[model samples]
Target: MTDLDFYARAVVDGTVMGLGQDSLPEDWEDRLGVNYVDDVRKGLMRRDFGLVEVSFQRVRGIWRCFGVGIQVHRLDRGVEAVVPAPVRAEFGEFGSPVGFAGVDAAVARMGGRLESANDGGSTYHDQFLSASTNARVHVVAQVDDPGVGGTSVGDVWSIHLSWRKNQDS
Candidate 1:
């Protein structure tokens, strides 16, 4: 079985266009690797980027990722205004930021399937199971329309993935 962190990294990197922990905010790490245990012990901890908030949990050798959230910001020198349409289309015809359609495609590409789905107001949550392993990945995507610098940039989608430890690993 693959390690939870390993599988999770694969899923996260895969979904987020090859971004890794190194790409996460420096506040998310420590000498012990991701500092996930401390974050969880201290309650929901977050690593903030000007336009994003990331949370994760890895404790007792298990993995539990909270979700990555992106805030809509107006186009600026450093801020990029983007719609994940092309990215989502590459995965599948998932409509909107809160739709689990793209996630369905992501899981399929990883050789998995949607095991369950839950709707929670502005957020959509789903779980995927690996066919070749016992890993379970949970994903949460939020639909947000935040005004950045007084600009109304509509519906921005932010997503995060959490993975359970593989028993076999």
Candidate 2:
């Protein structure tokens, strides 16, 4: 297999994107010799979370699957809607900002059919699976920040990945 045959898969976890850790993992500051800071944006983390990007091998006959968490905050009168119960359980939680204009709703929104619990908030997710390793996918997350600047919402997205098998060039 040529160098290009090796594919890279990234899974972003956080409160907004819910890439995984609210606080980064111990060994994750830098791994696989890739610069994460460049793939992730911080200023946006104060509001949106779970945004992860990476560069890996591109191969043939490989299938890749990834997941990310998304969080949305809406005030009692703000624009973003609430996330239902079932959605929260799977995605994460629904929350609000303290001393802010609205309520808090956090959900595990992903890409696929959802088993909804209630009605009131906006819940969503997106997914793409490729049978070929040479394929790269783009995942978009939508999060609402009811409170900006001060409260932070402390939203952030981290990324991780798992891969196996080598392909030919």
Candidate 3:
């Protein structure tokens, strides 16, 4: 890897390591999945977002980490980089929104689904990376919010993440 790439990898590693070790989702191993190939992909190109700040929103319940597939890549993260996340959703059209009791009926008919989310924004910065530099990083956070009022749901609240090395330390 090039020097720039090496430094970028460090940042990506830092971010993933940080998230895994963060109080919010300390047990990432039990929550998410990872592999050797994807780990490299999770450390791809990364830079910074000038002026702007990173926002990893606060959430409830246990945070889990699942394996990131090939289609979705996780970009790297840098001191001055803003990595936008690209996610896919598999949400099917449920006939109607009935009472909480109807959720089971709906799932029994339409079945579960996944969908992709918006991956937008173009920004950069130069902090720990260097002086006056620009780096671009794109990541994917797969956060699954199990619909409320589900009794059997093992994990009431959780999120799944996928994308370019996208960026898993």
Error of 1 at 162 (Å): 3.5
Candidate 1: list runs displaced more than 4 Å. Answer: 1-24, 27-44, 50-52, 56-79, 82-99, 119-158, 163-169
> Cα deviation in Å at residue 114, candidate 1?
1.5
Residue 53 miss distance in model 2 (angstroms): 11
Q: lDDT of all predictions, in order shown?
A: 0.37, 0.25, 0.23
- In candidate 3, what are the lDDT values of residues 1-169, reduced to their tens digit? 2222222322333233234222232233222222111111222311112211122222233223322111111122232122222111112221111121232233223332222222333121111111111122222122244332332222111122222222233
lDDT of 1: 0.37
Report the lDDT tens digits of candidate 1 across residue range 29-139. Answer: 321123232233443445544333455544444343445444323113232223233323333332222333544555566556545434343344344444433333444
Candidate 1: deviation at residue 92, Å?
A: 15
For candidate 2, write residues 1-169 as lDDT tens digits.
2100111212111122222222232222332122233332322212121222322222342222122222222322231233332233443433333211111111112221112222323232222333322121222234355333223422222112334224442
Per candidate, the number of residue pairs that clash is 1, 29, 46
Q: In terms of TM-score, which candidate is stronger, 1 or 3?
A: 1
lDDT of 1 at 124: 40
Indicate whether candidate 1 or candidate 2 has the larger lDDT: 1
